[model samples]
Target: MALDPAPPMLEPPAGDEVARLRRMAQRQWAARRDLERRLHDGAALRVSALTLRLGLLSHLHPDEARDLRTAVEGIQDELHLVLQELRDIAGRLYPPLLDEAGLGPALREAAGRCAVPVRIDAPDERFGPDVEGAVYFAVLGCLSDGAATPVEVVIRRQADVLRVLVSGVDACDAGTIHDGVRLLGGTVALGESPAGDALITVRIPCV
Candidate 1:
């Protein structure tokens, strides 16, 4: 299949373009970080409190406590699940490992979470936070498209540009992927691989 044309480029003076892109990237990152903080500080805190309350159940009379203990334990188990889910959501918003470690480990963790097998070739290197975030999500958007398994991701720096290549499977929301890349002043190209699988190449100015 023929690939789609690139999205319309944003026209602005060099200084204006950089400033605009910087603001856009900062806004996107801030929104994600805010949501993650809310999840951790709100729901996660509440769940912890609930678990502490369950501990107080032991103060009741032995007969009453024994009778309710089983039920309370069940509830506690469910709350634990809720906490796990909250953390997962926070991680998805902005993976802590990404900051603690780097792009390679962060992408590897993301691939491990996928149900399908993914082969990755990302050097253990760090890029600007905005640049890394854009690249990570761009590849993630492709993975979440529910395409065929055994996807391959290759990341490298080409002079002043950071490149990410994703291959395997076919079919994705090209527009969504393009928008994410474009936010970081990057370009996204969609085409067919030699093996007939989908190929997505992303180039971002990292310098």
Candidate 2:
């Protein structure tokens, strides 16, 4: 009775595999920052200058050409809209607040944009950019989209580990959160809160 050939032994991930993931994460962060800089310094600046020029042209136009003034003003309005959209895109790509104010302020700003109320409990202290970015995006990803249910977010640092807890959100994509956290040598778990809300817990090591 040879019991089913004893299931094959499972092997842990190789060191090279972990290194590759770290490299990939670094590249992604660099690319996002570069793109955000270009949008802010290049495209956004150019659009803003064009809008100002159009405004000046409208003002300098003679009263005889009322049609031309109206056209210039219309163009200025469109340019303004474009500038706003560019800034929004840049913010989404990589928020400057994260770099300047650390994780707490950045998360607060994001929470302000949500339709439902979000309560946050995090320290104002700074952490490595990779650690902060991973935790910020993880929490942001778990936020309820268009749901009226309020969310509760908590962040704490213990010795060398950074822990994050999110509750009151339902239907979260745990796989996506897991992938993001795993790249930082972290773990993510899905559970239920005392109030019966879906809870997500994340732990990442940081120096």
Off by over 4 Å in 2: 1-16
Q: TM-score: which candidate is best?
A: 2
Q: Least lDDT summed over 10 consecutive residues: which range in candidate 1?
A: 169-178
TM-score of 2: 0.83
- Clashes (candidate 2): 0
What is every candidate's alpha-carbon RMSD to the true fold?
8.7, 8.4
**Off by more than 4 A, model 1:** 1-15, 59-63, 171-173, 192-194
Total clashing residue pairs per candidate?
0, 0
- Clash pairs detected, candidate 1: none
lDDT of 1 by residue, 20-83 (tens): 8867897887678677778877889999999889877755646787768878889899999999
For each candidate, give its TM-score against the true structure. 0.79, 0.83
